[model samples]
Target chain A: MKILIFIFLFLIGPLTFGQEALNIIFQPKFETENLVINKTYLFKTDTLKINSFKCYITNLKYYKNDSLVHVSRKRAHLIDATDSSTYYISEHKFFRFDELRFNIGVDSLTNVSGVYEGDLDPSKGMYWTWQSGYINFKLDGTSSRCPGRKNKFYWHIGGYLPPFNTLRKVSLKLNKSHPRQIYIQLNKLFEEIDVSEVYNVMSPSDKAIRISNKLQLLFKQVP
Target chain B: MKKTKLLFTLSIFALLSFDIIKNTYFFNPPQYFPQPTYDFQKNPLDSNKIELGRLLFYDPLLSANNSVSCASCHSPFNAFAHTDHDLSHGIFDSIGNRNAPALFNLAWQKSFMWDGAVNHLDMQALAPITHPSEMGSTINDVIEKLNASEEYKTLFFIAFQDSIINTSKILKSLSQFQLTLVSASAKYDQVMLGKDVFSDQEKNGHQLFKKNCAICHTEPLFSNFKFETNALPVDPSLNDLGRYSITQNPEDKNKFKVPSLRNLSYTYPYMHDGRFATLKEAIDHYTSNIENSDRLSPALKLPIKLTSNEKVDLIAFLLTLNDKEFVFNKKHQFKKISIETKE
Candidate 1:
């Protein structure tokens, strides 16, 4: 009887005390097509090969007309374009929300804090080892349009300092009629950024702060 | 009634567990020292964990080529700062950009690196382990090597009951060992604690130090740890702009983290670029050689003036900051692992 009760509580605990995974899905796309490694696509009459794209999505929260509703505290979701399994956000209980918000990078508190496991781990390639901060957005690819050696470009954007604090909060409004989906449009980013002149952005700087703004616009409520 | 009884039992168990952890290892600083900034509750100190960290500190497996260890640059004998080379050397005889600073009293430090680039002590090792001219290895690669090593598996199990090695475990273990390096047993500390008295020359030197250098190199820790301009001209060869490289702020140009003055004798070849070789040269640079710059510390716009005799007196007081007991401690030295190895 005791064993049965323990099992029952374990099953129902999350549902009773929030933090149960939501049905919403995060989809990564390039214009109309799905993003996948080993796939080459045309970017302004040049073949562009996306080697990798990963980002940190943190501080997921929901609100209804400015009233506090739900918050997924002390957790950061590491999203990788190559890994389709990482696209899901383990969300809290959601009855209804008018405003959906999340941060594009790790918070300053978590960045200054010590080692973490799983998604926030230093081994994840998302955290910059040379400097202390999580790489909020990482995108590396090679394109014929890029003038660098082998036509490669890498952008690792992160900083916790002022004037270059790359952590950006993304806010999107939710309509009750729309499907529970968030689309991360990579094409919108490529459309604005010049590939040849702006190749490398490895550290936190004025350029990183600008690129971080462009990354913020990538996420949108979809379907 | 049953729930109350269960809660009472759990509270008792939690108290006992807390007692065991507290008794395992206690990091006690001198009474005058400030509380350590490191959150001990998160990564509690255990003797086994600290021992594992000490072994890892000396292990060359942290390097990509396995030829250079952390001790290659940060030797235990030299107050954990290399005395052989001014600039740090890494695998394949690669040279690093800046001088390897001494590592002691790290728990009280707010940030790591000369530029204050690294914010936490646990994350500080990652910079060297992955820097191209340093160990030239990744956290994942080092962890893979540790997981494959038979000896590490046993040691890790002893440290943290689980044998599976990960990044957090490795970093926390390293931090646990470094946090134990508290340099508060110097003669200066003894004098402060009413156990000893300073000589007349040393006493005069201490007073002079308080007047001239004490603003930045505060007593107790002997460093404010804030990024400040020492007005040393940038070395043209390296073209290192110090904190400006990290912050990109023009005001922060030619600035470096104020290093602690504790254990100065063992950690010589002083300054950020290791330009000054001896105590006299470093002191001379401060007194007469300070170049005027807009970003210079307001107090140092006019270089300090000191007679040759007063300089000698100040040097005597500075020598008292050297913690001989810490440098010679057997516990901080490298150990020959007695665990059976498969390799």
Candidate 2:
């Protein structure tokens, strides 16, 4: 009986400690090397500065050893594109997180009409309040190759209804057993998206759909 | 050991039963209606939170200058809608574009506003709160003020189990309180349930309403809640393209969500732009004043030819729709504690 107890303890110890974890970072690579923060335009755009860019990675789930496990939602929250101090995740229950998976735009269920707040809040500069939809991926900046000389490019993409629904699903595998960071290249997203088509996507329309489709293809799994 | 196990089991059982009773007592619904659109699971309705919402609804503190509350335009006495004015007056006596809609049975409404611009009732308050001519305050600013108020902090803690006065909690509690404003005790409801009889004139009017307007204004809720053009000419001054403003589709131009007739007596100056002041005027519009348009509802294609007597009968039928029980319910009234504190 004592030997059996010893065997059970030994097996449980490895089960608890053998799990692996990974930290996934969604890095936005700008077309130009330099990016402008709130007021100041800086020369370094390759490195994502905290508090400068706001994007949501919502409804994150972990798929390990086949079965699906739900991770704490607020754990994966808003990231700043300017300040490094503000760049880290606060709720770290998944500190030993082995894999990372999440969707960019809101899930189809939330896309339907109802009350929403936080990243889903209509006033958070992420949603188009007037249109009753979310801007799935917002790429706002000034470009010289468009009309009005200083063009403001806003990709307000999302709608569940026909002719305007722009929901995109992105899936990636961590590949390595204990990967530390996952990198996303935003420059590739713009390469596929014609600055001309996206330049005019001011609302939820066919253009928004085209841009979202193109942007999804640009998200690559890095080593 | 047996006695100790029994005690532990009893305590757990007590806590479990307490939770069950709590849920049942909190989620009582009116038998007449279907389930509410709001998923209480996301934001559970607590008595404290509901009370907090009630206070917020009546509090003028939500406004930028603290001069007007939602009740200013939508008073409880008038079934949460203002009287004597076709248009709603906002902060600094500035008039809004449309009339203030009566507030009640909101849980049943999938969309809000005369134009249906706001799809969710949770986000409904933000429109009036942010409109430059309306309250002129951001939700975040309103939250900041609520957070600073010691009284509000305690109330939020009670209602949400958390003292954080964020926009979500504010909007959720407000909606929970509004959802509880179910108006089902109207004279029409009694007549429908066969508990009471309508006057002969009211009965004839009811028949006329069924024949003429029932296609759009369906019974029980008194509204199909669908958008209809109704064939009325656009007010030249307002030029409001109701649903089209939200949809941006030319087909939805001039289409407005059908207003519920549960409290038609108190909620006067009907239609989206408050075009008709009286039931007779509205009946006349449906009869003789329907403008020819591509988006006109099929039911209203043929002009309704109602005699003066028929118009009076329609008015008599409309009077039965008034739910006096809802208007006078003390639970739906202003928070006495805050009012007393202020006094």
Candidate 3:
């Protein structure tokens, strides 16, 4: 009887103590509808087909009662909407998080801090070869609204420098009474996007900053 | 027994001190120069790492085709500046958009590239290594290539203690080698140190430089490293907007980083585009051919009225900035290692 009790306690102890993994699920959406890559989606009056969508989510922080409680061990993560593996955050400690905060791009320190492994690796194709600095947000696709060659629009937004710093801060208040997953609505981002005028923003420019501002309104708590 | 214990302690102390000295690499800049902006404490320089970087810099294996190396464009004999071509020629004889600037006194520079595109020295090599026209290879490709080589594996083990060839180690080691390229042994530096004196023409030219050029090309470093439009007309073909391309501000249009005046003789074809092949032409442009523009440097707005003799005197003074010791330093040369023997 004593041995059985000890075994039961040991089995439950590991589960009770810091073993619950907090999962943050990122679901790409277009307003009320689900977003599927390579499929034509009617956005406003123009038809658009997103071939790829990737962005670096960095400096994740968790808060309880408006006070900072937990922080992610990983400094940065490259999330691909197409890959479900890239959308979940399971490495962080379990916390009854009331609010979550993160940046949309790599910070200035990380930009100049040589190279890093994992998502920050240069092999990720998110890094600029002509200049230094990671592309904070990359949105590439073909839009009928675009007047450029092949009707293709590519927006690679990033700049860590002053006056043109494109790193955006996103804070979402989690409804503890509801589900834990955070849904990143892609429709809200494209609502204000005019593909024709600002199609090819490959570098840190005024257009990149403008697009980055639109990207800031992409997160919301989902039930 | 007490004496033996004291001796043991002293020996241990000596060994510890030796270890400390070995780890702390010092940057021996001239007394007149400002403190370096690079925080060496973050990535402490080690001799092994520098050796690895030197090998990497000379090795063309970093390129996709293994045909172009950093030294191909930045030759040590030419003060690390490519002089044969106006624009840098890279893999497959592809011409680059800008001239390859001389590599020296990099520890003091706030930014890299003429347009200040690269923010850090460690990040500078990525631009060339991955550029389509340059080395034309990714960082991962370079690492894989280096990892496969037995010589590099040994070198990496020696340098980083871990034989794993990662981007951090590669970039940091490259920086360690470049940070050591100091060009402070010129006649100008000697004059500053009171070790030598300039001739009459050189002296006159120095005074003129102080009055006219010293605002942008500041003393000691020979540059403030700020972006300025030196009145050169924009080449319609290249259409290089300089700083404006990075910042997208109309105010920054045509503004290029002020280059150092050191090694002026070896690093010919001056300016960002390498439009001027000779110092005389550069001087002539400054004196006569400064096209008026809204974004032109305020200092150059007023015409630089210099007589032909004054130009000659200025050129003579500029020549004093040349450092043959730096250009000919065998320490910066390619190490003649027999890969066959090592293999």
Candidate 4:
């Protein structure tokens, strides 16, 4: 009889446990040492890690706002991170008001489905072909001052689909302010990225772990 | 150790019982059809998932600007095919190059789309969702939209036991709803089962179909469902080369999916381009201007000489293939949720 009770409890236990849900707000930011929109930057260090940086923000509101509208019931919009061309500071619509959110690598899911359009669309180039998963977030551009080439650097970070599934969720708390904005430093993320092999991540490899850890550090509280 | 062993054995037994009961209770294939081509072992059927897919199919949120839906073209009243249009129209009033085919009995289909671009039903929605001129949205966008809806969350939880909607769940649910569109209760099916006999005119039409059309239309399901070019002239304006666009093989230029003859009474203006609006016009094209092309089916080496009386008989036989019950079934219609006006 005891064995039967144990079996029943074990069978039903996992299903009964409710998951913890949290309300998270993302902010975006951009900084420059010798900044120009079209030009690239380079670092002398062999490795670069954007450990603690900020995701800046503007025109943000809770419940609702004019320019910063939430997608009905959902709280997300395409930052149009494709390029600064369509989403540059001078687009005149205050388009550079960045809001950062990420799935980054993988979440806990068993099966993968096919072609998703939107922020997850292939037009964004955030999809993985080898294992079939979305990268959730991508931070890629050229860094010229880096030691790799005369003026060349790359940061392609994403992986999700077992064994190498490396997406992480983050939470941020902010004090009472009209708008929320935060910064993420590239110091640690650049440091953690592999310099031994030019530290490029194409698929789910050791590179996924390096980039995932570096990305998690970017999410911190706003005072 | 003994307690652990006993618990493990009981859990396994319960799992086995659940599988057996669910498989037996949920699924019921028609008596006459062969084993479905879809491997159900990969994705199990669920009542809730089917319900969720039905909701999504009719929801405009699946489009780029939330303007179009799967039902925009493949309406329930039209047997899942668009009516009164030769080519399917999409977002911003953009015209797609091909007609929207009727969607049903997908479990038996080995491939999807008129061109067979996607090999599995699981991967089929990706084509229309991203086809620019079609739904003009991506599966990811659709998932995000679904995730936002409280009603969809409830629907998703009911279907997959969790409200965390993803691409897999969305695709599987859509597949479930489409897979259930089995049109097996037509008058032709009744005649086959000896429940009803065809009228003398229908019987004559049946014999004629067997002679000229049966080699392609086949029997029972009324489709061989193979790619065959039935010698059609190219429309200069559209310049669309059916299956060749996907395969890029010269041999496949004019070929298209040989559509099922079932539901012909409802699925009018046939062919990939929907050029012919009536069955008589379609039959006449086949008999008259069967343009000789390299990819034309060997069966059409010579023109099919069908007299006017024979055309009437052939159409008579085709009309009996309509499955009205499958069309008006409330299970596949729009959800009763009041459309929320955009703020």
Candidate 5:
């Protein structure tokens, strides 16, 4: 009985010490409610419906204690609110992390590199045809406040060139030893955007840089 | 002895295979040309991919209404430039702001478009397909259309060894075809290669060109590919600020890319706005109508003084740049394979 117990303990010890999978869940929301595409909702005293929302999240970095430990091998990820597959991270193996760092859009190097597959695919509709860079964030919808045809509003923000680069960095501190989820509030973003005057922002301009700055405020850590 | 013989045979086989691969993927630029800036190592050249891109270039299915293709604005007959219109016309007869420039020797170019908006050659096609006045189609929609066709599925399979129709394959194929357009068969090229001799009049014109124009329009390729203000007065109606729109720097105001002087006979009217219809008019503008400005090119600051005889001789020298073999290359032409026949 003593020899059998010793054998069991030796085999189970290494399994416990091995690397465990860390899951990071991203929940996109409009205020307190879940975001549903094409559903009408009241935003800033105006009726609006979001038809599409897609953006690239890239260069994920992991921190242990106060030092940087590991960075994601994969360069970028295309996240669409409509796609459930994009809501979680399951590939990286990590037991614990104290801080997480990532960028909201593709970096300058990836923008100039020609024709990438998967998340950076041109067929994803996040790339600009008239220019060389990818559209970092795309937000399309219809609001009663807009004066354009069919009351449509479109904002495609992305630029890698100096003075107009819209790529933003985000850093979040984990409260618990291991965080399971992160929340991005869309209502806070909608409150700042005025659809009536600035309805269209398709090119790399001053307007795109302004809206990208506002988008950075919407990300928060969920307890 | 048997083991040694086997090793010798294997080594010979490996050497032959390596030679075949090298010939298949070589870029083969002219001896006088500078090294191409395009990183061919990233997307290696393959004949199958080039053939696939040729098909895509001539296919009208890439457009939203299935009426416009890349060849619509960039015809092969005119050195891949559209003629009969000052400004390019797109789907639904919508007019674009700028003239569609001739396409060739793209591997040597660092930037594309008149404004230099696109920084890479592979990404240049995306602009026309998605522009509202152009094809008016999304890359996703084009992929969906390509995937539905049995012909494209087989071609994609042959080119990539995978039947999946994706954007990366589509773009890489296009780049492969465009990079193969090397305009090295011109009379000017023949003279440089010591195969042909220029006439005495042409020789005189060449000397004049070197003295007056070679600073911006450099030798061999005939373009430095830098943005410079040619001193054309800004058209108040068009309000085109040229490179200023892209860079937003005050110094870059009214600067436009120095276009290659090759194929001047086929690619006209000249300039960014297509304001000059004839080479004589273009020469006249450079000598007399240069609007003085701080942003103008230093080479052109002192107005070029050309005699009437010098102008005629200069035009004669420019005509030597016309490469008929390149213009009429059947491989670059539209492949008329019917959808039913292809399937």
Candidate 6:
């Protein structure tokens, strides 16, 4: 009985302490295969090609039974299509979590505060230079359906002021037993709007706000 | 124990020396001035950072073709305001819409630019840097160039402890230099400080200014820094709707920020578009040419009826506001930076 008790104590000690990393993979797919920059894809019989895609993700948090369990130390993350390590979040040890919560863009308070470093820096190509604001979500591409010079289409969405604030919060329930992976599906995003009509969104306007609200639907925790 | 004691004495000396250096570059505005709005805690002034900012300010490499710089329009000799040219000339002889305003006493300004578009001083440089007709360059390209340069690499490492050139450090360094541009040594300031007395003509002009212009262009700072319509007829070609373009409010149409009266002698031609070439013309517009429009500020509805004599006296008082010491300050002048073209 003494030997059994010693074995039990050793097994339980390993479970209680240390750190864990969560892989929040943002997978942008073009139909079946993964999305590649400047690669042509069939868009319901129309030819489509994406040149650039980027967005800011912030306010990462985790919850268990509606109680806050973890929060991210990173102020903001600029998730560029070319950079795979941008969205992966590593957190301190937590026993259990039922919900995955985060924002699709930087908050209004952070926007007006001033400048930033690292991923939030203006040199990241996500910040607007003329007026003060960050380009919260950017998607530039070329499609046969798009009507423009060289068949180009760009949607640079961002705003912090009221009536046009584009920041979005996404809270998704998780199965405690499975690995955490957030998938951002491009096919679902394409279905939401026609690329021809809503192509040029470069500033803070009603269209930018509407598209930002629609972005919450693009993220999910399921397979 | 003797070695430890010696180390402690050396550390104390180092701290004292650093304190003196910091004070030299410190944002020390006059006691009469209001508290500065800049959050110094965010980016504290360091001698190295200010020097880096000065270098960046004069570097033509900031422009797209490496031909124009911030000093191209905001020359130091004219109180950092471009003289002769009413409309600012940008890269490749491209003309900008508005006159480049003088840069001084910026620490007290709550917002920047003629339309108050920029909420912070740190972000103000972005406008000129990226404007197509101005610098015609993007912030990313500028940083890439700076990162590639050997001179900037060394300067940046000295300014910021780490050598990584980022936007936060860049803007913070620029603000540190600009915040030190305190124009508080004018003859007007001397009179206020009781060191000197105003001339009889200036004394009368001071009284006239108090009665007519005091409401909008307030004292000490010389501007209330609020948006007000002075009722200038819109140019048919430009039709610039000043503050309304930023806010999109009907009430703000044709309303530009009330400029500071200090350095009025240096910053010209006056108004948002540099329409008036002389002080007399600017004053005359207020007294006689104000359009009877509802958009006009209540003070401008009556627009002070200054006699020709009063106008002369007011000009005398305005000239006293110029601080010659500031415009000629060697510290603010250009120190040429040599750069290697990124291979």
- Superior candidate under DockQ, 1 versus 3: 1
The interface root-mean-square deviations, each candidate in sequence, come to 0.6, 2.3, 1.7, 6.8, 1.1, 1.1
Q: List the residue pairs that clash in candidate 6.
A: none
- Give candidate 1 misplaced runs (Cα > 4 Å): A1-21, A64-66, A92-94, B1-25, B340-343
Tens digit of per-residue lDDT, candidate 4, span B144-252 = 8877886677566555667687776787788877877788788988887889999999999999999998888878777777899987777998887777765556788
**lDDT value for model 3:** 0.85
Predicted structure with the largest DockQ when compared to the true one: 1
Taking the tens digit of each residue's C-alpha lDDT, what string does model 3 give over A19-106? 8787777777767666678989887788888888898989988888899988888889888877878888775456677888999999
Q: Where does model 6 exceed 4 Å of error?
A: A1-17, A31-33, A176-179, B1-20, B23-25, B336-343
Q: Among all windows of ten consecutive residues in candidate 1 chain A, which has the lowest summed lDDT?
A: A88-97
The CA lDDT at B234 in model 2 is: 73
> Which residue pairs show backbone clashes in model 1?
none
Sequence-dependent TM-score of model 6: 0.89
Pick the TM-score winner: 1
Taking all chains together, each candidate's TM-score versus the true structure is 0.91, 0.81, 0.87, 0.60, 0.88, 0.89
> 2 or 3: which has the higher DockQ?
3
How many clashing residue pairs, candidate 2?
A: 16
Question: Tens-digit lDDT track for model 5 on A1-223?
Answer: 9999999988887667765766677777887777788999887678988898888889988777867877777688887988967877664466567787889999999888888998998878898777688999888899999887899999899999988999999888888843767777877767887888878999788899988998778777775
- RMSD per candidate (Å) reads 5.7, 6.6, 6.2, 16.2, 6.4, 5.5
In order, what DockQ does each candidate have?
0.84, 0.38, 0.49, 0.06, 0.69, 0.66
List TM-scores of chain B, every candidate: 0.92, 0.89, 0.92, 0.89, 0.91, 0.91
Residues A85-164 of candidate 6: C-alpha lDDT, one tens digit per residue = 76576664545678878888889888777788888888788887777788898989988988988989888989888767
Over A1-223, each residue of candidate 1 has an lDDT whose tens digit, in order, gives: 9999999999998878856556556788877888887588886776888899898988887788887687865488898987898887655455567777889999899999889998899888988887888999988998888999989998888897898899999888887765467888887878778887787989888788878889877987775
lDDT of 2 by residue, B1-343 (tens): 6776576446545534544334336455446666667666676665665677788889999889998888888888888887667888999889987889899878778878887767677778877888767788787789889888867875665455577777778888888778778788888878767899999999999999999989988876778889999887778888888888767788999888898887887878887777788877877788888877778988888878899998999989988989899898888788654311121
